[model samples]
Target: MPETNTARLVHRLATLRERLQPEMDRREFLRTLVTGGYALGMAQLLGVEDFLAADDGEVPIVTARVRENPDDPFSLVEQTRDVPAEWYAAVQNAFELNERLARIAYTGYLGSAVVPGDYASGTASISIGVSNEGQSAREMIRDVSEGISINTETIIEIEEIEDGFEYAEPRYVESVDDGRVPSGIACETPSSLATLSPALYHPDEEEAFFVTAEHAFKDEPDPVGHPLALPLDRVERLELGTVVYAHPGEDFVAVEPNGEMRPVSRIAAPSPVRVRGQYTRLGLADLVARGEELEKVGALTGHTTGRIQGVDAVTCFTDEFCRRGQIRWGGEMDLTDGDSGSVSYHSDPDGRDDDVLVAGFNNARTWWPGQSYVWGVSAYKLTAEHGYHF
Candidate 1:
C-alpha cells in the first residue's frame, strides 16, 4: 500500500511540473519576480502613504485627471489674412515707426514737465497712443508727478496742433511770455506757442501707413463660427500636461514623486480654461505685429489638466498679484491657498504635435463659489510680445 501511494505521489508531482514549466522558465520567472517586487515597493511607498493617512481604509476619490469636451466653433475664426511678404515687411516697419514716434512724443513731453520741479508737484502730461482708425495703439504711458503744481492761469495754451510725420519737418511755433496786465501787448514776452499751419504740429494722423497687418486685417464673416473648435490634434502635438506642486504660503514649492522640493510662483488654476476669440478680443492686438516672429518659435509642453475641488476661498499675496490684463475664464474650478502654480490643461484629441499653442499659465483663482473666477497669464501674449517659449 505504501509503495503504491509513493508511486501515485511521484506521478502527480511530475504532472504538476509539466503543467507549470512555461511559467517557471528561469528568465521569465526572474523578470516576473522583479516586476512584482518593484510594484509592491512602489505601492507601499506612494499609494500606501496616501491611503494610510485617511480616516478609513477606503481611498478618497479625487477628480479625474483629464476631461474631454466638444470644441466651440466661435473660437476658431482667423482674424487676419496672410499678406504678401513685401507688404508685410512694410507694415512691420511702419508699426515700429509708429511705436517709436509715440514713445518719443510722450517721453519728450514728460521730460519737459519734469524740469523745474513740475514732476514733484504732480504736474505731468500723460500720453496714450491712438491710431488713425480711431483705435488706440497698444502702448500707453502714465506719468505721475509728486511735486510742483500747475499754475493754469499763468500758462499759455496751444490748440489744434498738427505735428507732421515723425520724419517730416517740425511746424510748431513757440514763444514764452510772463503773465502781466497786458492784452496782446507782449508785456513780459509772448509766453505762448501755437501751430502756424498744417505743416506739422501735433495733429492726429489718419492712414493705414503703419498699421500692423494683424490689426489691419478684419475678421472674415463666418456664419458657421468655426474658430471655436478646439484643435485637438494640435494640443496632442504639444505634449502638454500640468505640473502639480504644493503651495507654501504665497509661493509654490515643487513636489516630486520622491518628495523632493523647489520653489515657484503662487499662481493657481483648478480647471483648464478654453481660450477663444481673436487676438484683438483678447487685448493682444499690439503683440500681433510680431506674429510672424512667433510662428518660428515652439510652444510649451508637458501641461496637463485636472479638476480642483473643495476650495472655499483663495487669496494672493498682493492685490495686483494676478490682476494684470490677462484674459480670465469664469467657472467653478476651486483652488485654495496651497494650490497655487498648478497647471490646468484641456485634453487634446490629436496627442502631441508642433502646431499646437500653449494658451495660458495658471495665475490666480477667485474665492467665491458659483463664480469660478480663474486668472492666467496669456501664453499667447507672452509669445507674441517677448518671444517667450516653454
Candidate 2:
C-alpha cells in the first residue's frame, strides 16, 4: 500500500478510538452509580461529565442487574443498557421525587410507586395509593411536586376479605437427598407453613441464609431463634434451620442453616432454574416498559407467571409503618397463604435459558376491592438497606 493511503487509514482508526473513549468512561461511571446504590452523594462525587456531554438521542445507563458467581458474591458483574436520554432523565427524576414523597409520608398515605413510560414516550409518573380517610394526604399529593406527573388512587378497604389461601399438598425433601435445598418448597415455621426463597448472601459476613416470610411465625411466643423445619409428610418434619433475624417491616426472616443442608441458588419448578442475581430499580423499570412477565414457584400456587404491576413501591396499607422499595407484580391468584416467601423472577438476559434473576419475595397479596396484585420488598431495596444479595 502507498504511504499516504496507509497514513489516512491509521488516522481514521485513531479518530474512531478517540470518539469511543468518552462513552466507555461514561459506562464505568454509571456502573459505579448503580453498584453503589445510586446515592445522591455518590452522584455528586462522580461528576456527570460524560453524561452531560452526550447527545440528546440516547444514553447508556448502568443497570443494577448483575451476573452473580454463586460461590462468590464479590465477583458479581454489573450490566448496562442504552436507553433513550429523555426516558432516562424522566425515570431518574421520578425516582428522586418518589423518595421525597416517601419521606413526607403524610397522613393517610397508603403507598406509592414510580412508573416509567415506554421508550418512545420518554415519560414517567408516580402512582400514589391513599386510603379513603386520607383526604389531607390526597391534597398534599396533588401539590407535592411540579414537573413530574402524579396519579392518585383511592384504596377502599373491603368489608370482607377474600380467602387467598388454597389447599395443596406440601412438598417434602427425602432424608437421603442432596444436602442442598432448592427454594419454592414447603418449610414449616412454629406457627405456619411458608414457601422457601432463594439463598440470600451477606457479603460482609460471607454467610448465606434460608429466607422466608416473617409473618409465618407471627403467632410465635418468641420468634427469634425459633426452629424452622421442613415437613416430610403430614406427621414427620426435618429441622432445616433457626430464624436468626426477623424484619417484620420487610416481612422476611433470615434463618441460619443448621449445616445439615444449605440453601442453594435454585428454584424448584417443572424445569428447575438457577438464581443468577436480581433486578435493580431501573432493571425492573425496564421490564415494566418492555411488558415482561415475572414467574414464580409458590408452595400452594405452584408455578405461575404474571405482568409486573409496579416497581420501587411504598406500601403502608397493612402495617403501622410504611415499607419502601416494594415491588408490585402479578395478581392475587399468583400468590396464596402458603406462598409467602416465594420469589418473583424473570429470565436473566445475560445467562443461560434456565437462569433467572429474582425480582423480590412474594410476601402478600392485595385483598382490597380495587387492587389485585402481589406485593413484596424488592431485592434491590434489601441490598441497599441491608447488604444482602442473591
Candidate 3:
C-alpha cells in the first residue's frame, strides 16, 4: 500500500509538471521540485505552507497594518500581519494583470479592478469593463491577460453622474457644539455643498491643510481661488480657507485655512474616531484578505460600514482620464450627492478608542449598470503622487 501511494504521488507530480511545462521556465520548473509532494500553490492554498518558498516552504507572510505616526500622513510605522503566502501571490498576480491591462488599454477597454480572495482560499481575479468595440480587440487582450481570468462588462456608452439639484449659496454654521469639526459635515464651495475631511498633511510644506474632493468644485473652470468654509445655516457661515491646490485627476483638493477654524484628525462618528494613520498598498490588501470592513461618515449618509470589495483598482468608468489605485467597497447607495470628500476608515484592532486608520477618500459612487460600490483614491496613492498624507 505504501509503494502504491508513492507511485500515485509520482504520477500526480508528473502530470502537474507536464501541464505546467509549456509555460514555466526551466529554472522555475526545477525549483518547484523542492516542494516534494504538493502541486504548485497546493500546499499554501491548503493553509499548510508556502508553496512558493523552496527551502522548507513554511514561510509566514507578513505585512504592515497600523502606522506609528497617526497624525503624519507620510508616517511609515505599521503593524505587521501574517498572511497566507498563496493568498498574497494570488492577490499580487491580480494587481500585476490589472496594471498590464491598463497599460494597453485599447479603445474598448473601459476599466479594471483587482478582486482579492479571502485568506486560505488562495484566489484572485480581475474584472474588466469593456465596450462592444473592444470585443474585436480580444486577441490582443488575451495576449495581455496571459491566461488570467478576466471578466468584462460590455457597455455601448457611459455618462457622468448628474443630479440637477442646486445647493443653497453661502450657508454658514456659527459653531458646532463640539470644538473640533469632524469629517462628514457640510462644507461650502462657491456653487455646491460638499463634505469636509480631516487634515491633509503635505510633506513639502510640512503643513496640515483642510481637504475635500476636487470634483466638489468641478463646475468652476479653476478652483484655485475658491473659498472653503463651514456652513451653520443660510445666514451664519464659518470660513475654513481657500483652495491652495486642486488635483482633478485624483479627485481631491487641499484647502489652506484662512480663519481660526482648522482641520482636525477626527472623523464624525457617534463615538469619537481619531485618525491613527493611513494604510500602505499591502496593508489594504491585507485588510481585504482578512475579510475586514471599513467605516465612513458622510454628510448625508452619516456613518456606515462596508467590506473592501477590491484593492488597487483602476477605474476608467468615471471620467475621460482613468483613475488608478482606487478602493471599491460598499454599495453605491452607501454614498449620496453630499457624501463626496468623506474618508473611509477601519477601527484600530489595538483598541485605541479614538484611533481609526483611514482607507481612502470617498469621491464618487457607482454609475455603471453592473458595478456597485463607492470608489475613491487610496491614502497610499496620494502619498506616492504628491508626498501628502491624510
Question: For this target, which candidate reaches the highest lDDT against the unseen true structure?
Answer: 2
Number of the candidate with higher TM-score, 1 or 2: 2
Tens-place lDDT digits, model 3, residues 39-111: 5456544333433342331223334334465545566554645555456666766788889889887888877
- What global local distance difference test value does model 3 have? 0.74
Listed in order, each prediction's TM-score against the native is 0.21, 0.84, 0.79
Residue ranges of candidate 1 with Cα displaced over 4 Å: 1-322, 330-332, 347-357, 368-370
Candidate 2 regions with alpha-carbon error over 4 angstroms: 1-56, 68-70, 158-160, 174-176
In every candidate, how many clashes are there? 38, 0, 12
Q: Pull out the clashing pairs in model 2.
A: none
lDDT of prediction 2 = 0.81
Of 2 and 3, which scores higher on TM-score?
A: 2
- Comparing 1 with 3 on lDDT, the higher-scoring candidate is 3
CA lDDT of each prediction against the hidden true structure: 0.24, 0.81, 0.74
- The true-versus-predicted C-alpha distance at residue 13 of model 2, in Å, is 35
**Least well predicted 10-residue stretch by lDDT in candidate 3:** 50-59
How do the residues 20-126 of candidate 2 rate in per-residue lDDT, one tens digit apiece?
32224456645654654445454433435435465545665656556556556567887767677668768877887899988987776788888888888888899
